[model samples]
Target: MSSLYLLHKPYRMLSQFTDSEGRATLADVIDVPGVYAAGRLDYDSEGLLLLSDDGALIHRIAHPRHKQPKTYWVQLEGQMDESALKALRSGINLKDGPTRPAKARLMTPPALAPREPAIDPKRHPSTCWLELTISEGRNRQVRRMTAHVGFPTLRLIRASIGAWQLGDLQPGEWRRETLHAPRPAKSAKRSGKPTATRPRRHS
Candidate 1:
């Protein structure tokens, strides 16, 4: 048997279980021993982060060779246009390297909780919303990409990874489940049985 946990990692929480500094880490929320985050989400970023006690599962989720698609709901600092979207979809060059092509589209913001430090409406900066799916994970890749296209990301919330979704889990919440293999990856969330939700966890 395997232990898999899907956590809605809150903003400002470190992806690792421990930190030299007293800042919040996964230890603050997760009590499941031996299960580690399969991939990382930046402290400034929020949303679904998968953890598992199984090493093979971790590799499958985190390794670039696996090419698991991660979907994000992004709010940007300027109006979005077709040209910018085309650059995102065609793979723009970044400091790290030229990125692989990705899926990007204009979107209405989804119902999400306000960040601890909400974007001030007083500034009244024009903004746009985009939903992007990319198979490659790089350090702050989405944020950098948006900025390269001239619409700096104001907020980044990863909504899904492959078939697993954040669903209705609020910040610092998690669910445990067993995933069976061999299903169609693209359609799993839409067609699979309802995922069992667990109770909220507190630090």
Candidate 2:
């Protein structure tokens, strides 16, 4: 069994435990000794971050090859429309490479807490939020993707990673859960009737 922690990382905090200049990091808030961040969230972004003591588990969850979906609520600079959504779903070319197709849709106003220091209102006059779900976790991919489509991201909040959701976990808070839990058996029927009327005779 491995130890897994879900941390709601705060803005401006470094992803790693150690920082040369004594910057705020997981070490500052989380006292766990052995656990380490499975993936990284940039200092400027805030949201769900997973940490684990198991290296293999970390790779499986964070590595792009696994194609684990990560969903983010992004506040962009202008009102987004169907054309923008289509472009996002199609793909966006970045400096490193072209991003893979993603699930992009306009975000219905999230119920999450407001970010401290708030977004710059002057830079973003008519802003609209969008929900972007991507499997590839490139460096600053969400920010870059929105920028590529001409709507610079005003703010970004990761809503979920894999099966875990941020929920009401405030910034700098964390929760622990098992990495692998046994799946519950599915019900035999959906409409309260067995699919097979009776057991067939062996023939």
Candidate 3:
């Protein structure tokens, strides 16, 4: 069986093991050798990051073509309304391209400890906390999307990727898990009526 690791990556830690400047990395938190991060999370972002020794498994998880959904708890600069949610659900055009329509919805702020160093205060007064979920993992995609819609993201915490969730794992903690091939979901039967499938677009 292949080896897998789940790490709650803390802010300011590099995603890779080797850093020339001696910055903190997975090497600092996990002693497990031969495992590599499946995908990268920005050094400023905090949350669950998966690592594996199996190259094929890593490719499957990190490749955008696989379409594995990643969920995040985003704290926005203002109160989110239906229009913003709709915009996210429809699609957001970025410099990279148009992002795939996501499963966007407004959710109550999850119960959790306050951030150590709170997010930067807004220049203009605004509300806090808006949950955003996206299937595509583009480079700083969530931040750009919210900003494009006039709401800059204050903080981003990834809650899950595919079948793995952060759960109660605190920042800087690491755990090992066994990974298996994900089961494919059943597809709906075709009908005479034309069907609408969300187009695959780059973020």
Candidate 4:
């Protein structure tokens, strides 16, 4: 059986174990040997990051083809309008290409622990929070989406991925669980081909 770990990756920390630049890395927080991060979380973004020793599980979670949904709590630099939210929900044409439609909505500021070297209120006086959920994992996609809609993201926090949530895990804290094999896909009636399905999502 494989081992799975849910970690609250802190801001300004690299996802990998080593950093030649001497910046903080996962080794500072996670001491487990042989386990590797399934997907990357930006050094500046803080939130839930999944790590595991199971190569197959890592592939399923990290591969864009799997389309595992990831939700973020975004702090935008300006007031959010319905048009912006609608555009986000509809999809935005980015430099990489048009993104998939995402679940976007205005949310009240969440009560989150202040990050070290928090966003200076002087630089960004007015801001609003947004809850954005997307199935694709692109490099800085959340930040780009908000920027394209005229609202720059001042801060971003990934709230959940698929069925796993950050919950009450504090910075640098991690929880471990045993992995289980996924259910086999059911065969289609006409084609006799297996239909793809993922684990149930978090409510």
Candidate 5:
């Protein structure tokens, strides 16, 4: 049977199941075997991450060719502007190549918990938030794009990937579901507490 796990990863946690540095890992919480993460979230990022035992589904979720859009609530270091939004909505030229057009909108912050060690206010920089959805999965693409447009990102929380969402899961919480199994309408969410919060993009 194939398995899927939706985990709300907290910040500064590794996405791998194990680490030689003795840092907190997925094995610290996920007791199950034979399942691997479909994608990886960055160590510095926080939000929904998916793991699965189904290889094909993992490929579909992680492959850029599939064009599964990723959504994030981003806190910018300074104010947002029309020019920046236009550039992002169109495409941002990065070192590698130009990104595809995205669904970009400036938004008020979402209701989320504070980071364990809060962002420093000493810099006295104004901050704005944006909800960005992109189909292309690149390394630090969202942050790089925002910074490319002259607004450095202060915080980034991924809200959902394709059809999956963070929903009501809190930090370190996880829910498991098996697609092949039959179920009633309500029996979907499973619970776990894992250290990793960053789900990876297609790599």
Candidate 6:
């Protein structure tokens, strides 16, 4: 059995265990040894984060090729129109490349504790919430996507990743789950002769 940790990572905490700059890190919240973050949340972002001791599980969760859907509750600085939602659903051409189509829609504000340093109302007089889901993992992708469509993200909180939900865990709180490691697919055997099979491409 493998150990998986679901942590409600707090805002302004580094994803890693150590930081030379004396910033808050995972070590401050989680005391688990041997397990590492499967995927990273930006230091300024908050919400669910998965950690595991199994390398295969970590790869499956973190790799973009796996296409695990990550859902976020995004607070935008301004109201986002339908046209912008449609654009996000279509695709956004980013500096790295064109992103895959995503699911975006207006949503009611979530009932959660206020951030330590909350957004200033004066800086953003009008704000709206959006429920956005994307399969691909890119560095700062969610923020960039919204900014590209003219609605800058003021706050980002991941609600779920694949089937894992944030649930009732409060900031800095964590829970552990045990899971069987994923088994690799076996190669097909031919009756007459050994046939060569091309490796599957991740893309």
Please list the Cα RMSD from the true structure of every candidate, rounded to 1 decimal place.
4.1, 11.2, 9.6, 6.4, 7.1, 9.7
Model 6, span 1-203: residue lDDT tens: 56778888899999999999999999988887898999899999999999988998899889888899999999998899999999999998999999999999999999887899999999889999999999988899999999999999999999999988887777888887776433455533322222222221211
Model 6 residue 110 CA deviation (Å) reads 0.7
State the C-alpha lDDT per candidate.
0.88, 0.82, 0.79, 0.87, 0.82, 0.87
Candidate 3: TM-score? 0.83
Q: Model 3 over residues 52-150: C-alpha lDDT tens digits?
A: 899998998999899889998888888887898899999989999999998777777776556767765656366566666788887899999999888
Candidate 4 TM-score, C-alpha based: 0.88
Worst 10 residues of 1 by lDDT: 188-197
Q: What lDDT is reached at residue 56 by model 5?
A: 88
Report how far residue 40 has shifted in candidate 4, in Å.
0.2
TM-score of each candidate structure, all chains considered together: 0.90, 0.85, 0.83, 0.88, 0.85, 0.88
Model 1 pairs whose backbones collide: none
Q: Model 2 has how many clashing residue pairs? A: 0
- What TM-score number comes out for model 5? 0.85
True-structure RMSD for candidate 1: 4.1
Candidate order, TM-score descending? 1, 4, 6, 2, 5, 3
Which tens-of-lDDT digit does each residue in 1-203 have in candidate 4?
Answer: 56778888889999999988999998888778999998999999999999988889899899989888999999999899999999999999999999999999999898787989999999999999999999998899999999999999998999999988888777888888675454455632333222222222221
Model 2 lDDT at residue 144: 89
Q: What's the ranking of the predictions by lDDT, best on top?
A: 1, 6, 4, 5, 2, 3
Off by over 4 Å in 2: 180-203
Give the least accurate 10-residue stretch of model 3, judged by summed lDDT. 194-203
